[model samples]
Target chain A: MDQRSIADVTVLSPTGRIDLDTTPPLQDCLLPLTQVASAKVVVDFAGVSYISSSGLRALMLGAKAARAAQGRLVVCCLNPAVAEIFRISRFHLVVEVQNDLAAALAALSSSAAAAYRHG
Target chain B: MTGKPIHMPRLRLVGQAAEIGPAVDTVRRFALAAGLPPESCDALALAVDEAVSNILRHAYDAPVDSAVTIDAAADGEGIEVVLADRGRPFSPLDRSPPRLEGGAADRPVGGLGIHLMRTLVDRIDYRREGDVNRLTLSKYRTAALAAGAPRGEDGADDTGA
Candidate 1:
């Protein structure tokens, strides 16, 4: 469970079980970055099969921080099971969610490029 | 020394992993009887399935001749689920938060269970006592001690992969 930066976007691709045991590692990876860079973060859930409330809180925190930095948080590529979760929680209202990784990256890249061009 | 049995709803099953589906069905019934809405029942089943999946992968490690016990209960207040296993102590909530808005390439792999748990249930408290690991999940139908859960029935079935 790690996150990598691509161009101006950060992709989080997680596998295995995302329960109480594995969530801390993901949290540790994001906390510092939210404190540093204000770049767009897009979590790709294509590979993730499951998620829990603790995991959702972490995402909320990161997205909140990114927004504070004038950046945005977007999630994409959700497996059916995981996608059902986002739908139930209505997370789309707060954070943008996409169907595929390409869409997520394209949206983030274009948004950032637009920001750069304007500001 | 045999310890006294913990009096909670228990379902014991052996054999193939698919058997877990029926077990979840039983748990869903219990939830319905306990006053949980239809939608919540479905959500509880999903949570139970995820927990059992972990037991299948980490505890018994597949095709093992051991029984998985799922304990559930409700005290006219909220729903609680306790999944116990003798496998190694693994806490899914100990990981860092993912970069939900980070670049696709920078996002790490593996580690979304805790997030799911956090998002699905109102509160999930985990503990490892002696040789047993106990994960306690609580959800309320009315007032919650923490955050507000998504609005819906208790046993809403969702079709998904």
Candidate 2:
């Protein structure tokens, strides 16, 4: 429904349709936070049942924002239907994905923290 | 308040997978009217359904009471389909692609809706117009259509009929 920030990471969990009609709220929410703080970003797709090009664009923009901020963005808890989409689009290569919230958080924290910690 | 109609196509439905058949047929008729080939027509219909189905399922949580509009027409060499609704804006195209771990057979049947739309249509434009959400999908007819491609119609697959 919305992307929320918690524990230094931004979580974007979208429910309902994610086509041309319903992508803006999530984009508006995640893009700014990723840009400003460069915090670790994890998108929970558990509730998202569909993905369209407009939805793909939103994620692309978010990934760009995370990259620009020197932060990392990841995806987790994708349903099988949604996961098929990632495979077809080859988005699996560009984004980090995990099986659940715990893994996503761990990956987000560890990878992002390591990057910042090392630099 | 202004009294102007939405200036879109007349919308009619009550929400059911049954509605998908009619909805796809209606959009296909519009596409055919605009001179699209059979294959293109079917693809467009599928694309429309994928969007509409998402609205039926995730938007309203079922196929009932939710309204969908089909305002389709020609824009130069391409056809444009406008699917408008009052659901919350939760674009799936805007999200990062998830990691897939198995084949299509092992996959679920939901998330592919948007992917199918993107694969079938040339361009997808989404915007908010007042209280409703509007999605515009465009596609150009291939050379095969200009060469007299078959004009097939989708069967009415509604179980209720």
Candidate 3:
């Protein structure tokens, strides 16, 4: 897993399968970001070939924490298989999922701008 | 219905979470070979992975090495996967489904695996014969066997989830 910051948005790139064996690292990477107030987080699943319910749980935990902190968690670049799982689990309804990394960044930026303008 | 049995290669793996990858690969290959679409194959793989993971986590009391057997057979209607484990008897279907309507924070972390299994597959059955706990998950071929064989009446109580 790799974590980088782009335009102040925390982007997490996790590779391989995110099942029971691999979710802890992802949780570790995202949960801390959620604690930061107004944190903008985007998870890139481009390299992730598969994900199970455990992975979904980890994402949910991050999303919930971020929401509580008035931040945002966005997921993007899902392979078709992972996207199918997301659709089946109705994860798209809970978390904001973008098509790719660029789109996700744009989403976060626009949302941040909106918050700033409104504030 | 062809009235002929479809045979699929059986996959045997150690009861460990790490072992779920190879098992899912085997299921994906088998599903594709059986002419299932990629979407169906993905769903089957996910369901199988969840089942195996559940067994690895909840079935055993101690870290005794045991094998989980998975058999996939195309029943001219869809695909049926039987996962048999010798660990403690537990019925995944008996677990309550997660509440999916709530907010992300309010959503329970666990129980979603069982819920996914229930939604992804058309039917599931569980039986404890002696020491083996057998779980059969079936995904119907919506296009191929639309009006063919009747669903398996295993009478496995799927109360919900």
Candidate 4:
């Protein structure tokens, strides 16, 4: 997983399969981000070819932790296969999903601005 | 249409979570060679991984080593994958799919693997014979392959009995 920070949003670009063998690393990567308050995360699935239920469970925990911390998690650029899994399991409803990175970043930026206005 | 011998492969692995990789790899290779679409191959691989993982996690509680066997065959229009385990008998089809109507904070963290398997594949059948539990997943050729061919089942049973 390659991670970079743009403004307040952390972008995680994980390549290859996110199955039983791979989800632990993904969890480690996302755990710290969800610990901080108001942390924004974007997982780019453009290079991910497949994701098993184990991966989904890890993401669910991360999303829940992030929510508890008042943070946000968004996923984007899912291939049709991965997207179908997300849709069927309703992970899309749990985590925000965008078509691409640009859209995700834009949504994050607007949400951040809204937060600033509310506070 | 040309007559070609269907490719069938049998894989056996210890019932361990780490062994799911090799099982999924074997299924993906067979699916690709059988002319399945890339997305279909990924879906099939995911289903196999979930099934094998469930066996490793839920089937055995004792220290005894167990085995999970997977048999795959293609009949020109679709592929049939059968996974058999000798551990305690449990049917994944009996579990209901998790409800998706709730928000993220209220959603449960597990139980989506079987739901994905049910939705991604064209057909799924579960049965137990004696001490073995068998789960069959079938994926039919969709837009990527020629359609409207009579479906046939290649009886390549590798239950490892």
lDDT (tens digit, per residue) of candidate 4 on B1-161:
12453756578776666678877988999999888888888888888888888887788776445578898888766888989888888877677778677777888888888787776676677778988898888887775442342211222223332
Question: What pairs collide in candidate 3?
Answer: none
Q: Which predicted model would earn the best TM-score? A: 3
Candidate 3 lDDT over A1-119, as tens digits, reads 89887767888999999998889889998999987999999999989999999899899889889989999999999998888888777788679999987778888896543443454
> Tens digit of lDDT per residue, candidate 3, span B1-161?
23465767777777667788888988888888887888888888899999998888888887766668999888567788999999998887677667777568667667889888877777778888789999998877784553353333334744232
Write candidate 2's Cα lDDT for A1-119 as tens digits: 56665567778888865655566788887788678765788888988865654566677677667776888888888876567656666666557789987778777676544443554
Question: Per-prediction DockQ, in order?
Answer: 0.06, 0.03, 0.62, 0.67
For model 1, what is the error of residue B101's alpha carbon versus the real structure, in angstroms, after optimal superposition?
Answer: 2.4
Range of the 10 consecutive residues with the lowest summed lDDT in candidate 3 chain B: B146-155
DockQ top scorer = 4
Give stretches of model 2 more than 4 Å off.
A110-119, B1-46, B49-161
Off by over 4 Å in 3: A110-119, B143-154, B157-161
Q: Which stretch of 10 consecutive residues in model 4 chain A shows the poorest summed lDDT?
A: A110-119
User: Candidate 2 on B37-117: residue-level lDDT in tens?
Assistant: 766776677688778777766666434465666677764465767787877775545644333344222333235556667
Better of 1 and 3 by lDDT: 3
lDDT of 4 by residue, A64-108 (tens): 988999998999999988888887787878899999887888788
lDDT of 1 at B157: 20
Q: Score residue B69 of candidate 2 by CA lDDT.
A: 68
Candidate 3 C-alpha error for residue B56, in Å = 0.9
- lDDT at position A31, candidate 3: 97
Ranking by lDDT: 3, 4, 2, 1
How accurate locally, in lDDT, is each candidate?
Answer: 0.64, 0.65, 0.82, 0.80
